[model samples]
Target: MTVKTAEDRLHDVAIIGGGVVGCAMFRACVLAGARTVLLEKGGDLLEGASKANSAILHTGFDATPDTLEVTCMQRGYALYRDICENMNLSVMKTGAMVAAWSADDIACFPAIMDKAARNGVPVKQLDAQQARLREPALSKDVRGAVLVEEEHLIDPWSAPLAYARQAVENGGTHLCRARVESGVREGNVWRLDVAGKPAVRARVVINCAGNHGDLVEAIARPSPFTITPRKGQFVVFDKTASDLFRTIILPVPTALTKGVVVTRTVFGNVLVGPTAEPQTEREFPTVEHDALEKLREAAFRIIPALRDHDVTTAYAGLRPATQFSDYQIEALPTDGWITVGGIRSTGLTGALGIAEHVVGLYRAHFADPSPLANVVVPSMPNLVEERPRPWMQPERGPIVCHCERVTEHEIEAALTDRVLPAGTLGGLRRRTRCMMGRCQGFYCTRRVMELAQSHLPGLVSPTGKGRSDV
Candidate 1:
């Protein structure tokens, strides 16, 4: 596909950032029969925090009762469940358990249960024996746990891709590397000066820039809230260790943190850690050696068997923490803009609900409701054909990564996806797990880079310059 220029005319809505929240907002705008444009600073969609998340479909159990975040999470969970069923995306309904390790921790269960009930999440308190019966891998010292049956794991890669795919299918335009330098509101519309390109006009602008939310808000001048980057690092264990727990094991939350967790990813890997630490926006937010050690210690305390599992990978993600505890979703009626800020850790679970809410805000403020005709929900392409994975398809039968069983077909499909730019081996690895095996790209990095260079344009091949290093 050839690269296209930005549109000069005004759109119904222009969403800044191509992360999950932005993608969801774009889809919702399109579904409401509004012309929408999504601006992404990165080379492709999901290049930000959206792609590097814990990938849990939260049950609103941890959210404060009856708050906007909690309500949105619950609604978004249902919406995502429907979308997953319709799109054929990988979704695992593995329940989550909030384990207590001490008497004080055990005493907190009632309040947690009350919060869950207030949030409309069905949770049952289980004693250590019962908890062990449910998940035998849990440490015997577990005092008790609250079972959140509705909680599940989702494929992090597919969620944003599906949203972007559907948005494009619904005639929404997505522009990559089109960073919004600044914006000025003139009359009823906002004109955005996009990175050396022609200014694009829109009736409404929605800021869903994740970590860059504050930056984008500054461009609009006089921000309502500032965004802080809260970093969390995690480790992925080999799929052979997926049996470490039948359910997601979570530690009781403190005022500051949700603590460490051991959960099964939708991709079939067992994951642990995600220590929350505050960091500057300029930093890339990565795993610290000390943090990893602490995570391992906590993981072993929760489930001793995890210590025996071989780690496949380790990475970090930055959450866009804001001043407010609840979501800072508001419309700048005076500025003809809307800001979805302070999403934090629960953004993934609340994405769709937030999108829907943003759409209503547009209608209420702009007073222009287009015909809802031709409402279309795009079908997602099937990425996983079957289980025991290798024997599912001819391509899967050939192992590209000895540890992950990632196939050539999967990598090829991810590379060819128009919305994703798998130009580098690292990008491909993020998209398809091509080099995210136990060896951590030690064995297949060269081959993967070669394939990426051949498949993606403007990427440097291993043999050197094909396109300008510029």
Candidate 2:
């Protein structure tokens, strides 16, 4: 069978990014009976700002009321819960608490409660004693907290991957390493000039180009926003530290960010993170020593027991922030373009809802699309620790990665996935959790390289020699 690449065929909708929002947009457009093609500049999906996140599914409890961000978040939250089970995804129901550490934070409680009520998210106030009763691991400095019962944790990688898979399985095209360099509108169609590939023609172009949103948007019209990349650093604690807390510990919100959060990931590791700092680089977010140290200290402050545990790793991610606070989603019918930019931390939770909104825009301005009959929904492999791992199953192959318990079969499947195969080492790690463990692939690198020799190119061997692509 011949694999499909981005051809000269005129697609109905063309998405410019492969982040969570772009993946979700592809899914929605395909389901709505539109011929869609997603162009990702990276080797695989989620290579942009969507790559690293806290992975918390927000409830919009403290979101700015009556804003597009909150509206999309609530709708996306519902849509995710609705489709998770069908897609074989998991959600760890570790609710969150906005712990007040100071008198100023406590003073913000009334406004927080009012905002939650206005946003229609149910949240109850908990006194310091009551908060401590619920979470015995909290520090003595905790004054009060607002219990957000619906906030939860999810696999940040798997959800978007599932969306992309579902779209591909339902007849949508995904072209990786296909960067949109320039575009021009010809009558009713837009011809996008992709780097090294043939120009792709589409009737509608949605700019979901996360970090490069401004540059991409300028191709259609004068960009209404400027993308100032905000770097967020995080520290991951060992899985043993996960036992110290059952709830997501959040700090009071400020004008800049939601503040630092200490939460347990679905993979059974305690995560402390996300120091927001502004930067100009669109890619390559590096973790600084000072930021990591501060995050570690903050984690220790929140859960004193974390100091006893080991630090697994430290990483950083960038978010596409703009001068405005709310999301920038608008339809420019004159140019046959739509801009979905300035989606910062809430993009994960707001993806599906934003997709829905974009579809509405497409229908109103572009063309009337009939919903597809019997759409396909792909079932992703179970990655959440609560679910049964592949290594624990019958007929499981040899365990290649002992720390993450990734089996040889799992790696093979990820490498050869029919819809969206892992194109790079980072993609493979996200798909199988193979190199994201205690050892971080120290022991399994050679075997993984051997398995990927035929599929991936330019991979250096464990002995510092490059393997010829099969």
lDDT of 2 at 186: 94
lDDT (10s digit) by residue, model 1, range 222-295: 77777778888998888788767779999899887788888877667878978888778633776778888887
Residue pairs with colliding backbones in model 2 are none
RMSD of each: 2.8, 1.9
- Global CA lDDT of candidate 2, please? 0.92
Off by over 4 Å in 1: 1-5, 371-376, 381-391, 395-399, 418-427, 454-458, 464-470
lDDT of each: 0.79, 0.92
